[model samples]
Target chain A: MPNATVAGITVDRNDEGFFTDPNQWTEAMAPELARSEGIDELTDDHWRVLKFMRSEYAQKGTGPTVRVLGKTSGVSIKELYQLFPKGPAKTAAKIAGIPKPRGCI
Target chain B: MTSRIVILGGGTGGTLTANRLRRLYGADEAAITVVDQDDRHVYQPGLLFVPFGLAHTDDIVRPRARQLHEGIEFIESAIDHVDIEAGEVRLGNGVTLGYDVLVVATGARLVPEETEGLLGPAWMDSVFTFYTPEGAAALGAALATFDRGRLVVNVVDMPIKCPVAPLEFCFLADWYFTERGIRDRVQITYATPLDGAFTKPIAAAQLGGMLNARGIEIVTEFNTGEVVPGGRLTGYDGREVQFDLAVVIPLHGGATYVGRSPGLGDELDFVPTDEHTLQSKAASNIFVIGDAANVPASKAGSVTHFEGETLVDNVRRFLTGEPLEAGFDGHANCFIETGFHKALLIDFNYDTEPVPGHYPSPVGLPLLKESRLNHLGKLLFQSVYWHGLLPGRDLPGLGSNMPTAGKHLPVPEKD
Candidate 1:
């Protein structure tokens, strides 16, 4: 784990830049993290996916996959890509300040 | 009074649990009954080889009752629901089975209808799934005639039983096509929801490299949304991968009866279990194993086999008013078939990822690397599963916990 400064506050992150301890994250940190992933602004759609991810992780001890976010987070799969490019589950999870999703091999 | 034990689903989990418990307790002390809907217990791992024409349904399929030990009772009936409050399992025929302890091992069910257009007009025609005996037989017939086209193996969602089977399908297809001298005419694609060829990083890199070498195109992070028969697969992210022949692994949920039972299942109907203890969170008297439990381990037979060791012991303790030992370590050992008479073996647990080494001992079968010996092991396992695993006989060196002696841990990356 390493300490990094984002949104003018220091937080613990893994080598992959995901928050190690999700409790250390705050809503204030989403903007700066979004910018790093090349999202210029955090729209309401983006927040919807992110908030669902955090709340799901809080309850399930794991972040939701892209399908779960698309199906239940009220975000369509097409729009999830536009909100978070490349990989929606991987990218949104990082910006949402949560650990990477765990799927069995 | 004798302790009454009722186990649900006489598949791998229930059979093994019943056999192990029978060996642990005499019939006078504990009366054990195993319930399942049908008599056939299809060796699930054999399903993978069926599509490749290496195995047949008759070879793998056996009567569920025949596999159990002499003393254990086997009941054939559809499970209706679990009356958790009353500690009873109600069957469809209004027969009620009261138990001092209940083990739910009904396993995951393939719900192809969960995906849009998966079970559409083209199903069993151009599109197929090899997860079931009929599906595998149908796929085998379809594959034999398939000479030239875009062949795609798509995994619809995660936590599917035998997570590596799709990759094996791709590998075997590559071998099958090459053997037919039409390898150049056919193009293969592997589409998965995971962002890599596998969940483990090292194994993914290795398996991904094999896919690249075999010229198998891999489309990652593709969550399948719809299946257009004989045309294309549309992902939730709106990415389309065209396919002439599609072998789709559909979304898996626990048995439907699980959903009907109160406090027994999650949204997906899998039992919410304490990963370490294999005890259902729904009640202390209930335990879960195999694909029925929502544990983070791969939903493979090896997991159920490993979990059996701890689960049976804990069941004994649970009956005696002793403290339940959190003995299960989520050890999963899998033999991955990479085609062309070669395969790879991986041994891992909840805490450790697959690493390069040998298993059981330093000189044992190689792990995370392909070898002919491993392929033989994979073939030999079918017999071992029927005789050794089902009978609850201990596999000398292989235990409930993962062995770390032979593994070579990856060197930390220099930042």
Candidate 2:
């Protein structure tokens, strides 16, 4: 419930970094957030996947599942992993101004 | 006074060791007693099948007392601690036991709480483990509703019981979802702290290829530091893996009683044992076997089967004031389930890794390769485990030491 400042943003995050207030995430904080996750640069392909997750979550109130992302997000599951390393969905959710999608991937 | 033997634990090791020692010393020469926390003796390997509905919980569990020899005593009580210097053990029920020879076989205990946030909000909801009967049953139900998303099977750390089990789970999951007609909807992943699929190169090469054939993604060197309820696994190095369903194999340590008994165990409470003799390094009169021993060999049933020969012989030698034979070679045999009505078998010892070969006979079961014959052999072992194995009856030609009679060992490639 506490708001911790991460990547120059005063954001509320759970202990494991699930965002409490999705609105606290700003475009300005993404580069630092990306650096913390071991991604040196967020390329155009990464944005395509990240924006797809954000647009899907804003409409459905939940991020797209891995299968849905592979089929509809213009990126395959293998490609999604290449974009976000170990955790594609959760990591994308963090940077896309969305709460960590609840209830298993 | 009759030379009394006290075996701590009622699992595969204790049951077999107690029975074997009784046969070796006869009723008049020695008295054997086995102690455990409960009467439930589970066929541990069968737990893997439970999640897929291939094995029932009741079918895999039996009374611990029923496995012992006729004259051996079965104590249905929890152990408080053992006083090694005093040669006595105190039970939680206020019972005291004294032994001329002590056998510590109280195998590894699952420690999920050791990992940060593992027992968190999604403990049994999305995050489930199949290492225990209850966990397996819960995962079965979770998998029933789970038709989509990334399903990850992660082994928390190394030196876990049944090392191949996590890989076996991944293989079976492929078959399970395929049979359910929703294989394409679900994504399968296997995450381990190890650098590869298995410990040995030859077997890992084959098994790793099998995983790729099934389209299951492999996440190697993933040392999970925590599990968040939102279906995320965080690694020690700050990487993370997200999953819809997670089947976790937690770290294992020696039993709690081992910690209470001073000078009896390693830092992890696994008894520091001589690999060849099965005798505890702590004391000459004490011996350790099965998963309880801090041996380099696997903590599996076949290791206990092979150790029984040398362990019983050493007990007899100790009673008669003779030198103990360093007969055990840390031989281990494992049958890995690759799903789809086939399995792979491997045989090894302290020196040899699994290679292409035949076991026992030159034309016997295939090694390091999947075959229907190996699958049948694995299924047949349930009966053998109950009848021949626990009774300490050794299969002829299957000795404590490994043989290279028919194995095809390739020369090491230049680095």
Candidate 3:
């Protein structure tokens, strides 16, 4: 784990740069994190998915899977990919400052 | 009148809980009954070995009723729905059983139909899953004749029982082919939805390395959306992994009864449970165990065995009007069978990731490394599961909580 300053706020992150603690994330940091993940801007659609990911992580210990986010996040699966290219659920979770959704080891 | 306790499912968790509870209460105090649709209780772990011709259906399957203690009752009937408000479990046969405490151990159900085209024309002929007796037997026949081609093992989604089995299948397949002198002909690939070979970082790196050394390709973060008839797994993200033969671990959900009984389960039909207490969020009188509870631990048999101690104690306390003990720590111990009579053991809990060490005691079985001793331990566990674990007898040096004495803690890296 390592601490890095993003958007002028320090936060703890894992080796893959995912947040070790979800509470360290703030709205101000979303844009910079989004930028790092290749998103030039945080659109209203991006925020919707990110907010959903954060809230779901708050409820469940882990983040939601793509199927889960597509079903419940009010974002169509196609649009989710449009919002966050490649892996929507995983990439969105990265921007939202949450650990990647995982299977139990 | 004796307090009636009805347990759902006659599988691992249900059998152990009923037997354990019977030991705690006299027949005059608590009348324990375990119910399932059929009398067959399959040693689920043996299913992993079935495809490799190491075990047979007869070797794993046993009568569910035979495992229960003398005082415990066993009923073979389909669970229709649970009326939580009325405190009754309605059977498909039109019988109603009332209970003061309901232990929901009805484990995870395989939903192969959930995935698009998974059960298509190519099913069984080329695309196979070894999760069930029928599936395993069919796969065994298929693998016997499978001489050359790319063999892909794909895990459709998460929360599956025995998450390590697919990886084990890959390792065993490599050995199985090598033994048949077709190792060079058959190409093996492991595709999973997770970001790595495993969920944990360290274990993922280690397992990933093993797969590489064995010449098995790993495709990570690939969520299977559709399985084309001839031979391709199309990801939702439009990536594809082609295979000549595919062994798929389909999506899993809680038993259908959970979906029928409103307010009983979550969106996925798993009972929302207290991770520490094993008590269902549905009601105070209902307790959940094994894969049925949406806990963060691996849905392995070792997890159910570890949960048994805390769950039984909590059930006793809940019935006697005592405060329930939040004793369960999501301890899960699993043995990953690599090829050639070698296996890797991992012991972990909710807070701790598995590291190199020994389990149960400092001198006990080695952990997080492959060895012949762990393979023997894996084989010997079948007997332990039947004679010891299912009967609810406590094993010396092994308890509900994870032991820390033998485990080597990772040194903290300076920031």
State which candidate has the highest DockQ.
3
Model 3 chain B weakest 10-residue run by lDDT: B406-415
Tens-place lDDT digits, model 3, residues B264-336: 9876788989999999999999999898998888898889999999999998899889999889988888999
Q: Which runs in model 2 stand beyond 4 Å of their true positions?
A: A1-105, B412-415
lDDT of 2 at B261: 83
Worst 10 residues of 2 chain B by lDDT: B406-415
* Chain B superposition TM-score per model: 0.98, 0.98, 0.98
In candidate 3, which residue ranges exceed 4 Å CA deviation? A1-12, A20-29, A41-44, A76-79, B412-415
- State residue B122's C-alpha deviation in candidate 2, in Å: 0.6
In model 1, which runs have C-alpha deviations exceeding 4 angstroms?
Answer: A38-40, A43-45, A69-88, B411-415
Candidate closer to the true structure by TM-score (higher is better), 2 or 3: 3
DockQ for each model: 0.50, 0.02, 0.52
Q: What is the lDDT of residue B400 in candidate 2?
A: 69
List, residue by residue over B1-415, the lDDT tens digit for candidate 2: 5898999999999999998888877688888999999999999989999999999899999999999989999998889888989899899899999989999989999989878889998899999999899999999889888888899999887678889989999999999999999999999999987667887778878888989999999988676778987889988557899998999999787999888888887546678788899999888889998999977888899999899989989988987899999999879999999999999998988778889888865878888889999999889999989999999998877776887787887886543
Model 1: per-residue lDDT, tens digit, B1-415?
6899999999999999999999999879999999999999999999999987899989999999999999999999999999999999999878999999999989999999988999889999999999999999999999999989999999998979999999999999999999999999999999998879999888899999999999999999888889986679997667899999999999988999998999889778889899999999999999998999999999999999999988998998999889999998889999999999999999999988899999977999999899999999999999999999999888877877999899997776654
Worst 10 residues of 3 chain A by lDDT: A96-105
Give per-residue lDDT, candidate 3, residue B14.
Answer: 97
lDDT of 3 by residue, A2-100 (tens): 789999988999887888888888889988988898899998889889888888988877888776776688897767878887788778888898997
Which scores higher on lDDT, 1 or 2? 1
